[model samples]
Target: MVLSSPTWRERFRAGTVIPAHPLALTEQRKLDERHQRALTRYYLAAGAGGVAVGVHTTQFEIRDPRIGLYEPVLALAAEELRASDAIRVAGVCGNTAQAAREAQIARDLKYHAALLNLVALADSSIAEVVAHVRAIGEIMPIIGFYLQPAVGGQYFPVEFWRAFAEIESVIGIKIAPFNRYATQDVLRGVAESGRSHEIALYTGNDDHIVLDLLSGYHFSGCDLQIRGGLLGHWSVWTSCAVELHRQVRQAVESGKLVDPKWLLRNAEVTDMNAALFDVGHHFHGCIAGINEVLRRQGLLAGRWCLNPAEDLSGGQAQELDRVIATYPHLVDDQFVKQNLDTWLS
Candidate 1:
């Protein structure tokens, strides 16, 4: 009996951070329906009920089956995220029968969640990846891609997360493992699964997300899912990954502050995005650095369909614009040069 949402736990017990209002808009950004319901009430008052602004089927679908318009790229990724009120349009199941038919395209296209990437079934078993996440959680809310803990790269056995934390629509577990003692035994079977906040253990491990959030040991009370798993040196390491995830979640909720002057001003773009996790599909070099910054801000058209990610030529786009010119507040060379002709027309 552990499942609650009392208006997102009364805005996280009133500490607040809700954000999720962008529901795919158009009619010429001429937003009006009461300004899209006051931009989803300022995206649920900025952070939207706990938080979830997704997009990580490794660069939103390109595993190649001759990329036929999957319903116009899922309605242009849900109309470029409903022209941004905050963002929410995720449905990249891609396998295990398109993650059970994208859970009926996330409940008939009212998507707010469904991001399972069993990294192409990391060579099966963990009861066939918990029977393909109990057939995509019977239809939505599943987030289990323990990233890569098995399949020629094994070691994630806490009895395979005690059969993946007893399933009940497996709320979370995004490890990005290869080491860390099988993600510290899948965080001790998610705190002996009495169902910690129903479940959540997120951490795509970007170069040890601020020393694994200052070693509160494996996700001490988890909740951290950074988007576009930063592949190669994303414009000089996405402004040192937005101030090292805002100084490690503000030193885990205001323990004063600890600054490395923005991690030594983008320490060589976080050592070239921690040097592509030492070769060979280190999260597909953060999905080829978020598809070469969405194909240099044309919102992508091409960049070699997720093989060994190729395309950013001319000396790797001038060394990714010299580590994205040492973070001008996370990329603003004139908003990628005036939205590069309205996103590469």
Candidate 2:
């Protein structure tokens, strides 16, 4: 569906009532265009909040770079994400085995896009990455990543980024490393260039989105691909939390809902997600938590994934239950319910 965030002009176009259905995705190209437009508006709109969807690569493996494809399990995850309006879904792959599969998964599943990293590809050279991008571009949208080694040993040079961004199919960039200067430099370059509007600089700096946005320093930097507002546990928490924030922020800005009132309602749910970050082995725990939350609300069968098994343990699930009990508002139950109705009908 063509899901444009309801802006003031959009609201005026919408008039008194907002249609339940946004737009039809009769053709795949239209769907792609809609996703691109949505990404642009969400990042550039004043106070707009955008989210990058997360996926695990344990289930999928990209054995060869020439032909982009993944295992069946990865395909399943991508399929589920494609059906959701929560946010843009990208393969959050690990090591070399699965890294090659990300671009393939993005294409095979018809996913809106994916976040590419060294671990995801296992080949860090700009030349290799450029070739990978060229091949993947024929498949789906690719969001380039530059992460610090300590933050997961994912790093790509500024020159590499400049080269990658030069590609038309490359839609966005996620700056994951904590180095503020480098992020600023890259953003400054993007802004100075004529293509600022077409590309996005996503703040991978989880703790600093608000600071960067409010700062007088303006560059092509826009949007956030984070775990809500919580950054402690990144892998699993980033996209989900960011999704909640985007939905809450959009509702308030659209005048379809009031702030602080429903705003508190959204946070109440996000708090449960935030609490997951504090749990041990938070990366795995957080992904486990997402499925736990989903299963509790009957969204999924259970939390399941392949090796380095990031799935939550039984005890963590118990803790998640406790958190949910204390804060029932954390589930986005109403939104879930509405979608369920549509799906079942």
Candidate 3:
């Protein structure tokens, strides 16, 4: 079941906020089913266009045979998305064989596409990597991921992206290399591929959300824009993220000079991400930081992760507190407060 329908393609291309769904764990490090469901409901209520489950924010350890959570988490989110026309993306990693199995699972659950993480093939050549991607594309539509190297991602040059864009099943690319030059390489490659119009561009660069959405790239005679975001930073204060995305989209579509205030807000949003993503500690506490905010908002019970050693880095909580206190306009605590009960129920 390929998600090649014009309606789905048009909606994805139009751009919308897609939160990288985080895992909700019990105090014992077990899956918190109720809170898990609530998180999906919260994303939908907060006006997210979609939720990306089994992704980095959900914790890669979920695929561990001992933990066995990959399917259940994807299923929970799928259940919630059934009533909506929201795009469903399941994060699939590993080599071709493992990724194929994962893609089959997501396909069975009705996911619209696979956000293919290539970290597992760090040592493989670009040609080998493309082969892996092609194998999985046979099972479902693909959304190529360019995860930042700071977190298990490998560097791929413009050639790799050009080949990736050429894949017939690829419908989008999430550019999150976190470096301006690398981001441009992706834009150039996709533009050079001549398939830019067919592949939607999404900013996974949490640190540069506003500017990415607001900026346009002209390469190989093709003008490219980041249509939306698929971010972990978005999972916490989602209602505000939705509004921010709307404003950015409007500015981009209008093709006029953006107000200076939007540029200022970009730095503010980056600062917020720095705190929540544990930038000071090399992102050692990134996942916990996201959970900490949700915990404070009552959306999560605690900041527990699958690995016991994974918890907030020292001063990370202080940073989160500082950002939350300083950026009341960027948080959705009040929004969550109003509908927490319904979501929890």
Q: Which candidate is the best by lDDT?
A: 3
Task: Score candidate 1 by lDDT.
Answer: 0.46
TM-score of decoy 3: 0.98
Q: For residue 167, give model 3's deviation from the true position in Å.
A: 0.5
The reply for model 1, stretches above 4 Å from the true place, is 1-24, 27-99, 103-114, 117-132, 137-161, 165-172, 175-186, 190-328, 331-335, 342-344
Best-fitting candidate, scored by TM-score: 3
Tell me how candidate 2 scores on lDDT: 0.45
The C-alpha stretches of model 2 lying farther than 4 A from their native spots are 1-54, 57-114, 120-123, 138-140, 147-153, 177-186, 192-194, 203-274, 277-282, 313-315, 318-330, 337-345
User: Distance from true position, residue 310, model 2, in Å?
Assistant: 3.6
Candidate 2 residue lDDT tens string, 1-345: 898776432222121111001111112212222322332222222122323333222222223333222433334343434433333335545544344455565556555566665565655576876777766666666666666554354555556666777777776666556577777656654554445555655545433533332233454454321212212222222233445455643553464434455545434544554455323454445544654554454334444432235557557767776775786543445544444433323
> How many residue pairs clash (N, CA or C atoms closer than 3 angstroms) in each of the candidate models, in the order given?
13, 8, 0
Q: How does each model score on lDDT?
A: 0.46, 0.45, 0.94
What TM value does model 1 have? Answer: 0.29
* Ranked candidates, highest TM-score first: 3, 2, 1
